[model samples]
Target: MAVGSFFGSFDWSAFLNALILGVSIASIWLIAALGLTIIYGTAGVINMAHGEFIMLGAYSSYMLQNYVGLPFFLCVPAAFVIVALVGLILERGLIRYLYKRPLDTLLATFGVSLVLMQGVRLIFGSDPKYLAVPPIFTSNFQLGFVNISAFRVIVLGITIALVVALWALFYRTRFGVQVRAVMQDKEMAASFGINSDRVYMLTFAIGAGLAGIAGSLFGVLNIVLPTMGTGYVVQAFLVVVVGGGTLAGSVIAGGATGELQSVFAYFTNDTFARFMLYVLIVVFLRIRPQGLFAPSAKRR
Candidate 1:
């Protein structure tokens, strides 16, 4: 009788709502982690400044939309281009020198992150900016019994498109083969006439561009500020770490972690839920430190 009452009293409607929202949450995390995964997986460099790259994207969109009078839709790609260019310059000027020095690279990127943050803060003056989306995106629509934001749906669609595009880029193209070869063995790739330096430069730029896209989308979802990237980056790092720094791993980990967090929050408060999720993650890492999809052993 006790067990029956406990089961019967469970809120099925809320559970369904949580599940729906969980997918949205997963999309956000996956998009945020995408660039980090690409950078770390390909270059073997942990970019501590990735959050700054995201911040730049949001600011890039803001400037193009507000000053240049560009449409919001156009601003997205423009942000990508602008940030990718910045990333390219950064790789050429600084990061290219620290390739195999993990500790030095980590510290150097951390310094770069601080510089970017302070520079943006000085220019933007800590004011929270906003990205104005279309009226349609600002509206709420029903998804079965749940009320869903049209913007969230759009974000989810965008995330899926990015994933598919990345998959095709990495799996179907000649450039993809070169990238994989370099990742597997830089010297072997060089022996095959592939320019490892060029590959690293391009991949880093693309990864940064992906971060820019995430920032552009995220700006509309939350207030745009220099510090905005910090929160998303934490989640991004969590996704990448748990995912084992692979594209597919990020997708899987993002979904699982988002769903688990949502379900936990449904039962408890958000604070407690996060606490529980962190505890679980610690336990999981303890059991499998290599993560869900560790890189191939071929890579030194």
Candidate 2:
């Protein structure tokens, strides 16, 4: 009891530290989860390769910055465009064929992920690619007792802004309505003359674009690696399951879950923290098996 009490003291520094770490990791999960949710929820295709798209996006930033010597700010959008195009090509060439069959789609994407990782390794030689952030982002600022990296703060701002913009895109725009329509009932919505194909393409592009955005910022946070996407895939899957496959819920839940894991890991060891994360997923699924935020099902 004494030891437990000692560990549980109301120390402001520990509390703030936990909060910062939580917010940081949770935001990462949020980004990864957003891309996964968009593709999975809208198309009902579980894209196992979604993380590789993010990996590619990060690589895109590195190539543009280190290879072409583009300004850091410019590399960001280039990453987005490159990954978005990849998503488009994958959707048009592969995913479009596997639409009605869900499991096959998963398997296909899994294969694609393997190929992508290997391709990245073959090209980049499995060495972590270095991406240097601009001086402005590398600087740090203090908020009361908390000192935060400017880069992290910038990433958080971008994540929040993207979330808001996505919500608006889906909730306020005609394209969003069409996407939601297809999600709720693809066949029926298609019968209504909504171009399901276009909707799928656009949604897929958006998901990929979000991934590119995440990777652009994420590359600055870590050395870009071939299998880096492996880390994000499971976390995003869990976020989709926990949050119920909605774009908004995935972002919120992924961030929340990441934050929780980080804080728990801070108090515990890495293995135990991962165990706790899985336990939360099992506990969450037992409560809402259909997912927390899936659109109304139109399955006949």
Candidate 3:
């Protein structure tokens, strides 16, 4: 089909709806990628077990809501605390020792990923789990030509809140300064009495916590499974890479990719849309490998 003809036949209302859907999609990707961006951007650690952390978050929320009868809304933060603790333990026990050795860290985290996947499988079995939200969040709302889920709107609000909170945390806080100093020059940061080790530990924990929060939201969006993290992590990595491992980069990359994918999928099939998305990413990276927004020279 010719491009002009295709556009001529396109339903503008559907296109507008797709764009609105794109916002929700972007929020999802941004939430998932935010944690990874922090860890990799500041700490320079490519966390292979990130997906597992997300998985664990979903599981945490599930157990809390199912077994303890916790409210679904309250389970979100609970999941974060639980996963953050797990991340703390992993960083202190294993990740800390391997930071200087990037390749070893990668392999070790990959092993951790496997362990987490299997552990969840062993405990929860391979069956998919459902996360039930309140009735208010279960309905869809229509705005003009676009119809969207209430829960998705809530997720978008949460994502925006998180982005703002992170910005404040990274820029307006003393701890944030310490983290940025360590990222720019560890030796200099140390000379300035900044404990790089503690900074890294806190950063990793926060990252894991963010992933957990994302998992909780995702659980409601789709079925909760041990392997669900794998899918989100791929998109997270793409966002991080394309955004050049910056927080702003993640926001831009996630929004751009999510909208592009939705638009393409609207025009064609989902499978082909993904294929084209990947091809576009590849070509874009080839042309400007630095990403949409590159990190600072000192950080790099």
Candidate 4:
């Protein structure tokens, strides 16, 4: 009787909705973590200012949309260019000097984060800013048993495109070969005439540019603010760490974590779901500290 009663109360429709929604959640985390993965995996820099880079992306979009009268579509790429430039400048000016000094790089980037936050606060004040989107994005549509926002679908599309592009960049080009060589053994890559320094500069810029794209999308999901990146950064870090700082790892971790969280929330509540998710991550890490994919022996 008890088993029957439990079965009778099950809401298959809601569960299905949550399951589909998990994909959207996964995309959000994955997109945000993409840049962090590239930076940490390739450059070995614990970029504490990555969140600030994200914030800069959001503000860049906001500025271009409002002041320059660019549409949201144009703002996305523009944000990438602007933030990538900032990243290049940062690497050239400061981060390049701190290579192999993990603690110093972390502390320095943390200082950079503070500077960026305060600088933005001074320029834009504390009030939240909003990004405008098209009416289509504001609408909801049904997909099988689930109803989802159009914007989420768009985000998912963007995430897929990014992953595909990154895969090509990592596996299909001469630059990709150089990046992997550098990632595996900087000295070896340098021996072959691949400039390790140039690779690092370009990779860092690309990573920061990815964060910028994430920011533009995320700004539509929530109001833009100097501190908006804080919340997203936590989840982004989780994806990167759990995935072992590899591109493929981030993708798998993002999807698995997002789905697990969604299912947990479906069974319980949001807060408890998050608590349970964190507990699971802790346990998972305790057993496999290297994450989903361990680095090659050369990288180690």
Which ranges in model 3 have alpha carbons more than 4 Å from their true place? 2-5
Q: Give the per-residue lDDT digits (tens) of candidate 4, residues 64-159.
A: 999999999999999999999999999999999999897898899999999999999999998999999989899999877689999999999999
User: What is the TM-score (0 to 1) of candidate 1?
Assistant: 0.96
Model 3 agreement with the true structure over 1-300: per-residue lDDT tens digits: 988998789898999999988999899989999999999988778898999999999999999999999999899999999999999999999999988887888789889999999999999999999999999999998888789999999999999999999999999999988988888888889999999999999999999999999999899999999898888878898999999988999999999999999999998888898899989999999998988888665644
- RMSD (CA, Å), candidate 3 to true, equals 1.4
TM-score of each prediction: 0.96, 0.94, 0.97, 0.96
Better of 1 and 4 by TM-score: 4
Worst 10-residue lDDT window, candidate 1 = 291-300
TM match of model 2 to true structure: 0.94
lDDT of 4 at 83: 92
TM-score of 3: 0.97
Expressed as tens digits, the lDDT of each residue in 1-300 for candidate 2 is 588897677587876777897897788788877888888889888988988988998999988987799998888789888999999999999999989899999999999999999998998898888788778889988888888888887887877888899899999998889988998988889999999999998888889888888887878898799988888888888988888888767876877787888777877776799899899889878888877666677657
Q: Is candidate 2 or candidate 4 better by TM-score?
A: 4
- As for model 2, its CA RMSD to the true structure in angstroms is 1.7
The candidate that wins on TM-score is 3
Q: After superposition, how far is residue 256 of candidate 4 from its true place, in Å?
A: 0.6
